[model samples]
Target: MYCYVSEVKLVSLPPILCVHLKRFRNDDGFTKKLYDKVTFPETFSTAIFAAGQSENADCLKADEHYSLYAVVVHMGSTMSGHYTAFISSNQDWYYADDSCVQPSTWEKVQGTYGGYRQRSGETAYLLLYRKKSWNSSG
Candidate 1:
């Protein structure tokens, strides 16, 4: 018997990381959207996923971490939907939908983690994280 294995590693970590969630998929010649809840942390470290000898390895410092700063949410179905953005600025959260922007809370942002039902609702489509240091001056 023959077996194969593959590994993926991060060659570099940007100051600002953008993560895209795969909520849409093609199945049986049809496009389907997944309403699976995806829990993500407000802050995350990339050191474990980085290549030890890769370029920009210095960014994997022990105190270096990424803090969630923005989230692009999609509300509706696979065919039609509206887009909104949850942005964090100056340690405050704001929700922007079209021309209307309002103050929001972290709990409200977490609600976009999607649901178990097939019904349409706000879902996190893209996430933006900014690099920060655990110590001051981040």
Candidate 2:
């Protein structure tokens, strides 16, 4: 007997959902590459997920309420690719990223998304578009 399963079919049917991503632009020649997280307190409980396929995002669960977070690596204006984040209030479809937000408090927004939440001295960021529904098994 042979058994096989594709990674594409995984994390597709998340319990929660997110929203579509927004686009950003850069006028400089240098592309800023970066990574960050949106921490969730240990007391916090929720199971959230993204629309699978993206590299940075996930679903958080606490009791019955779920909050979805999109983790993005912004490459600034110099780079090119899909730079966005999806958020959701529905509980039908969702997505998830391999990485988890740490510190459990700070809602990490990437550079691609452009935010002042980053460190007092750090620059550049990324994004993971959240979604409320998806068909892919990412």
Candidate 3:
């Protein structure tokens, strides 16, 4: 018998979506890390990723949208590095560096796009997205 391959699509979505990127690679006896830059949006629609999405999903309601609230960043090579976080809450952003946490901005968060190192360009390792909620009373 031979192994068969199949493509599986996402049919449902959770209230929260956590996406982790594989940044580390090990081949033979060499360990390498990827420093490719990936562009993402602060707010996005998940309707496209859904399989057999309901017609209501096309309405683009608040519930179908998501906002980026947190990002776990990695700052060094594959062997040695530091992890930091950028979090957003109540329309304010903050950067957590070790024991220090300070107010930050959207422009600061965009610095994590890691292709070429430039002062504070750290790679994003994990992304946390929270679904937008609407008032039920409305």
Sort by lDDT, top down from the best: 1, 3, 2
Candidate 3, residues 1-138, lDDT tens digits: the string is: 999999565545677889897778898888987777776678777655664655554433323777889999998777888999999988788999999999999887888776755555378889898877543211
Give the winner by TM-score. Answer: 1
Tens-place lDDT digits, model 2, residues 41-86: 2111223333333445333321233234444333334355433222
Query: What are the root-mean-square deviations of the candidates from the true structure over C-alphas?
Result: 3.3, 15.4, 4.5
State which candidate, 1 or 2, has the greater lDDT: 1
**Cα error, candidate 1, residue 6 (Å):** 1.6
> What does the lDDT read for residue 93 in candidate 1?
92
Worst 10 residues of 2 by lDDT: 37-46
